[model samples]
Target: MMRSIDYGNLMHRAMRGLIIEVLRQVEEGGLPGEHHFFITFDTRHPDAALADWLKQRYPEEMTVVMQHWFDNLHVDDEGFAVTLNFGDQPEPLYIPFDAIRTFVDPSVEFGLRFEAPADDDEDEEEDDDGGDDDPAPSSDRQDAEIVRLDRWRK
Candidate 1:
């Protein structure tokens, strides 16, 4: 005999909930020693909000560095908000938990992948030096690009 079951959507929602919980821990207790996160998400996600100028600047995908001077970090049932210094200006951004596609910290070898909406275009990863790899700046941030985490996919 064969079994018939329906669980795709259920599993998807459950996994999403788990991802949010982990983020909540980081927001509440703070990131573990030397363990910061490289979070990647769709800039166009409905719940994602950024300065209009920022959207034009990043256009498609953006990665935020969550260490050092980040502040006002908050997370809730639907999304999260945080403030970071961009150049000489402080910028605030709100991104829904659902928009987060990849969360990882290479320093600790810990990572998580979540369902992510499709990106309409493909672009090169942006280095931390305000553009691609540059020879002049040595303080540029370099992090792996996070994308939709599809763990169960074959």
Candidate 2:
């Protein structure tokens, strides 16, 4: 017998498209009209490359601020890359199109979550605030770390 399609995965896939589009908007126009994005993804994912020092320090989740402080923003068919200063250190990151897991904009209460590709056998670390509602620091950084999540959508 024929099997039914999984709508859950289908929806997740659709959200993936929307997430990329939103990101492209920022990539193109530089976060127009008070629209900033909170994007979280796997730091150790194959296509992502952080300075060895940052990987040692964070080991897992990193969240980036796409407002006020980001540079070298470029996007292509493969994915996007950008430069942001973390603390006093500058880092470059390459993110694949399929690696983005969550996108949120607190300014408008808009959000999207998806099943991004996973890293292999890496122990996930919780955010420093113990999963509480602590605001991420806003600095004059040109780049921010991509935020990491404590839990998976699956």
Candidate 3:
């Protein structure tokens, strides 16, 4: 049996750390010219905190644009908090790092995709890959479903 280290998980953590660093910089001096973030996260994640109205609007997932007009931006080891305008009402949001699915900085054409933590039941299913009746999605199949950030750039 071959022992395989989970580099993918490690890379995910590193990328998440990068996201935190960028947010920290922005919190200190504000977003630089043409620099903004499109942060996509799973709304159903337990650590995700949002207004009831916003949750009703985005039941499954939500992408928040961190640009002008946001306030009280704070990032910590576990998660981040920011105030965004929803229908002209300032709404507070708290999202944990583990819930983030994608992070994109279109100005620089940079993006990172993360595999969200699987629920306990899903994790059990994933571990039972030995069953011949159920096959897991191939890596290529999963990649095909993800929208490439480069495609959005000129």
Candidate 4:
């Protein structure tokens, strides 16, 4: 029998809603205690809005810390916007829900990872290229440890 529901998608949506709710609370009142967020997103996603320089720097993905430095945070159903400092220069970023790869709050050891949608136009031949493939970690992720939730899921 065909599965009656898309449980994975539903779970993802619920988790995304949790992030929104947390942001809403933070907006009303500052983070209580040591709460903070580490949000990683796909820079190449069409809905991601970032500075040209930032795009050039983090070509594939980028992560941002929403702690003591961010400002003008606005979250809507579709996405969120906030300004963060990059080398003493404040840069505004807009990231859609679809672009988010992960969200974590290390203070509480809470985290979630969302799978990015596959690109339909990708060439199959490009997958066979054998080259030096040392994965470069995102700069913001260096010190931000996250608790992954994959094992908890069936």
Candidate 5:
């Protein structure tokens, strides 16, 4: 029997906190060694912000890479914002924690997938992840071992 303690939610909080910590570190000292990230998030999330073109291009979801050239990476308790170059145009975006679908670091072959509850209740503030099941794979993840959190989510 599942306990009422809601360990799942706790774990989710921990995982999201982990991302915040990492980003904080990066914000302070910059990314270490070959450690870059592939963050896939829901474009339609209420708090997510992006350019009109980007939103239209990725109406459902979008993935961004943090590598050689990225700037203004600000991370707080709720989410993060960054400026990334797209075809020579620097685009800024804000991604909330719940909006993330997947977070992957191909260089270390580390990954995390966040999913909403099995029941589809879009109105619940604490019971949903902004995105769907469709994966947003990074080009570099082709050779890495991806970890999934699907079973635990169920």
Candidate 6:
């Protein structure tokens, strides 16, 4: 068979691109209508930048709301930077797109949760797959841990 397209990775890129585009629009003219965003990202990402206090507070993943008040909203190819009020004290943050786990707009009830990239251990296991069979799908049990976007939508 010809080289199979890595749709999973492709989808991840597309989703991140969608976020970049949306943010760029907001950066230019502000959020339209009732739109806002809740972005969750890995604070541990190598390139993630935030106040050390914030990192100490949220050692793992952190979620930020982009509604109401935010300042200096700037977005580029890699990610975005914004200043948010944290307990009445403004703090600056720079989150890389690849570090984002979820991006949601509650007003529209739209949400997306990214899958964690596969590990080398899983790859080694797949090498023993029996011949004459299609390659198994790349996924993990954690992939099933989805964030329900909305109950009323369905």
Against the reference, the lDDT scores of all candidates come to: 0.62, 0.60, 0.70, 0.69, 0.73, 0.72
Candidate 3 segments exceeding 4 Å error: 116-147, 150-154
Best by TM-score: 6
Off by over 4 Å in 6: 118-147, 151-154
Clashes of 4: 0
lDDT of 6 by residue, 6-44 (tens): 676667777777889999999999988999887877777
The deviation in Å at residue 96 for candidate 5 is 0.7
lDDT digits (tens) for residues 1-154 of candidate 5: 9647756567777778788999999999999999898788878777899999999877777888899889999998889999999999999999988787678887766787665554244343221333444444332112111245232232
Clashes of each: 0, 8, 0, 0, 0, 0
Best by lDDT: 5
Return whichever of 1 and 5 wins on lDDT.
5
Evaluate model 6: give its lDDT: 0.72
Candidate 4 TM-score, true structure as reference = 0.74
- State the weakest 10-residue window (summed lDDT) of model 6: 125-134
For model 2, residues 63-132, the per-residue Cα lDDT tens digits are 6667778888888766788888788666788776555556777666676654432322235544652222
What lDDT tens digits, residue by residue, belong to model 4 across residues 1-154? 9759756567777877888898888878867898888787877767789999888877767778888888888889888989899889999999887777678887776897664233222232111122112233232122212346432234
For every candidate, C-alpha RMSD to the true structure in Å: 10.4, 10.0, 8.9, 9.2, 9.7, 10.0
By descending lDDT, how would the candidates be arranged?
5, 6, 3, 4, 1, 2
Residue-level lDDT tens digits of model 1 in 45-124:
67799999988876655777787767788888888899888897899999876566566666656565443223223354
Model 6 Cα shift for residue 101 (angstroms):
0.1
Off by over 4 Å in 1: 1-11, 115-154
Better of 1 and 3 by lDDT: 3
